[model samples]
Target chain A: MKGQRFLGLGYLGPYIIGLLVFTAIPFFGSLYLSFTKYDLMSSPDWTGLANYERLFTRDRTFFKSLNVTLLYVLLTVPLKLAFALFIATVLNYRLQFIGLFRTAFYVPSILGGSIAIAVLWRYMFATEGLVNMALATIGLGPIDWFGDPTNALLTITLLRCWQFGSAMVIFLAALQSIDKSLYEAAAIDGAGKVRIFFFITLPLLTPVIFFNLIMQMVQAFQEFNGPYIITQGGPLKATYLLPLYIYEEAFKKFNMGYASAIAWVLFTIITVLTLIAFWSSKKWVYYAGDKRS
Target chain B: MTDITTSNDLTMDETARAKRRAGLRLFSTAIRYALLFLVGFVMLYPLIWLVGASFKTNSEIFSGAGFLPQNPTLDGYIKGWQTSTPYTFGRFFWNSFLIILPKVIGTAISCTMAAYAFARFDFPLKKVLFGSVIAILLLPNVVTRIPQYILFRDLGWLDSFLPLWVPSALAGDAFFVFMLVQFLRSLPSDMEEAARVDGANSLQTLVYIVVPMLAPALISVCLFQFMWTMNDFLGPLIYLSSVDKYPVSLALKLSIDTTEAFEWNRILAMSVLAISPALIVFFAAQRYFIEGISSGGIKG
Candidate 1:
């Protein structure tokens, strides 16, 4: 057992080296770097709290980007999850050509994160784009997706929400694993579909929902490609997600220290949100041991 | 009206009820299919339009929202392939492949080993190490980006593919490790134990036994690594400076930046090509891909 203890390190050698170099060292190194002023050209100069002070007190763009990021996450995560669950439920029913429909739903998610899709989204939401033309055909005038901040944000959210296939696929698996007897019993008791979904199915599926929520929230928080490509966080900085801000600060402007601070703040937000989700999961997320099947 | 229920003299009420039930079922099915088709169309329209518009003449790209071109041409594909940059799209694809091949292969091998150690054996600080693995899993990669960049810069790896794939090669991506760990835990350890009884070392057991069993999960890891590396704009954007070193993702963006009036068709054509690798791999290995995602979410 003692020999095996050391021997385990042999197997884990590459991962350990990676974890320290990439994750551990950098994770804490950034924390230290956040306190000092550093540009790529020079060594970090000690300036404790200056970067953070500016961020909290004077940096207007920080708050704007922060607000945009929070709103983006708030809008995208729930909408995506809800859309996914809705679709998953629909697809769960035994229908002809179900696999085709499933493929159609899922294809977007596989490609959604690519810069290619982001570029595509940019064109599709243009003033004279297909979306507007489609709306025109319906007698509704063109909605300037990029001109209005809300619409622009919604447009990006739709891009995120459009790729709900992976989450939907996960939900489908969970839904399928649900005991048929539970549904049969509910039907025998004269419960309606909606009622059964709410009382029985939903509660049982909370764990998966919780899982999807955390995953989607993290992804949404770090959303860059769509906002970056479509508007470049533009038309009045309406879509300036924190990631864009951080990227600009760190790379474009070379404010490494400030960028690190912003990155830390973003990290703190995710960690807290994730911790809250975990704490809250105790109340709602049910672990069905053998009951899942 | 007969009080007794008989096939010969079916009650009028029961007949009506059965007919109504049948009608309701049929109606519901119709509604479900209608909704599915409507939303599924919404989900797929952008991609469909991308492909359709890729073949359109530049003049006809903004002609209307319809995906079909009035006069379709391969002009977009032809010009997009011969990008304005000194290097063509093939160079960018090769660069992306270079990064993806190493990263995917590394992730499959390194992550499987790490997952094996964490899942199977008792080690010193195993709990702590595993805890950190989960912590790193949740930790935002952005937080580490700057410092890691500096580290790589100090290592003189900037402007090269080394910085992009090296860390991942070393198992820096904790999510893959966590996923593999979850998958491994769900598996039986009895096979490895039997291998141990036959005097085979752990590495030999892993190579000869565990890897075969771990094939699906490893394939998922590779596929994910491939797609993510392909999609990654920021990594290459940050690290690679030379035009020749750009990946497809960065190249696509470069096309957008350099082109004054965006040639929508050309951009769309390249977009189609850039996403093709992922799309092809996904649809081909879709069953394992979905199973991998579901198992990670539910079991982990």
Candidate 2:
């Protein structure tokens, strides 16, 4: 028995070392660095809460990034989930060439956030690009996608939303698992399609919906590549997301301490939001095998 | 006489109801197909445009509104392959494979081993360890970037592929660990027990019995790691400073940054090339990929 236990430890040895060295150490190191003033050259000098204070009180870009990030989460999460659920529900039916459609819908997600896609996005939205040419046909002027502050964030949001395949796949899986008899019962009761959906499908799907919501929210909060590659958080910093801000503060300006503080703040926001979602799930999320309260 | 009249009226009502049902079914089917087509087009239009633009001339790219190029050219592919750097795009692709291959193998080995322990053993602190794996899965990579960068710099591991694949060997991706743990738990332990009763050791049982059963899950892990490492931008961007060590992701970005007159054709061509491997891999192993994603979500 003891030998077996020792062997188990041996099996787990690599992960244990990895967690301690990479995850645990860096995690604590960042927290410690958050309280100090350090560039890459010198040792960290303790300046307790100064980084946080400055971030809250004086840092305009910090607040700008925060607001931008919040708006992005608010806009993108719901839209992405709605898009996913809608497509999943549509594709859930028995139809010919359904696999092809699912694959097509998912391909964007697979290639998403690549420099290639970002570069393509930049071109497609450029002044004389395909988007503008399409707009011309519709009798509208060419809108400045990357230049104007108002439109820059929207352009990036669209890019993020375009990668809705992962969420859709999850929803599709959930939808398939749903008992078909419930739909039949609802239909037999003379319920309309919308009514049946709201009462039967939507209610049953709450758990998966909650799961997708939390995942997408966390992902959106940490989104980097879209805005970084396409807009570079430009046009008056309209699209300056938290990750972009943190990257610039740490790597670009070499303000490791300040960047660590911003990172902690971002971490807190994600944790709190996730907790709230979990807390809220108790009321609405329905687990199939669990007894109803 | 009254009974006969009532029966006849009921038959008439049934015919009308069936006709209405057939009409509604046709209407709904049309709507479903229309919506699917629209959404699919929206999802795939950008990629279609990308491939189309890659073959177009610089002038044609700006002027062309449609997906098809007026006059297709291979100059973009020819020049884009030989970048401004000393090495060609082939070198960058090779660099990507260098990182991806080892990382995939490392992830598979480490994650499976750890998952096997977690699933099979009743070791002390097992619950705590498993809980921590879940906790780590939620911890965003952004929070650890600065500290990790400093650590790697101190170790003099920067500007090399060591930082990319070494941690993977150590089971750094908690998600993969958690996934394999779930998969292992779902498998029957009867075979393992029988092997043990036959005096086969745990390691031997795992090698002979459990691993063969875990092949699909392991392949899923490998495919995922391959796709992610191939598409990874930030890790390579942060660790590798030299253009020579650059993966395709970094190489593609470098071209964009250094080019004075952004040749749309060449950039788009390289972009297509950069994305092609992922797309091809995805289409080929799409079943395993979807199974991994969907199962990982539900089980997690």
Best by lDDT: 2
Q: Write the per-residue lDDT of candidate 2 for residues A93-141, one digit (tens) a residue.
A: 8778888888888898888978899998989889998789889998999
Docking quality class, candidate 2: medium
Worst 10 residues of 1 chain A by lDDT: A284-293
- List the candidate 1 regions with Cα displacement exceeding 4 Å: A289-293, B1-20
Model 1, A1-293: lDDT tens per residue?
Answer: 66988888888999888888888899999999999999978899989999999999999999999999999899899999999999889888868988788878888888888899888888888898889988899999988999998899898998999899889988999999999999999998999989999999998899899889988888888998989998889768899999999999999999999999999999999999999999988888898873542
Candidate maximizing TM-score: 2
- A178 in model 1: Cα distance from truth in Å? 0.7
lDDT of 1 at A139: 98
Give TM per candidate.
0.96, 0.97
Native-referenced DockQ of model 2: 0.77
- In candidate 2 the C-alpha lDDT for residue A94 amounts to 76
Q: Number of the top candidate by DockQ?
A: 1
Question: What TM-score does model 2 achieve against the real structure?
Answer: 0.97
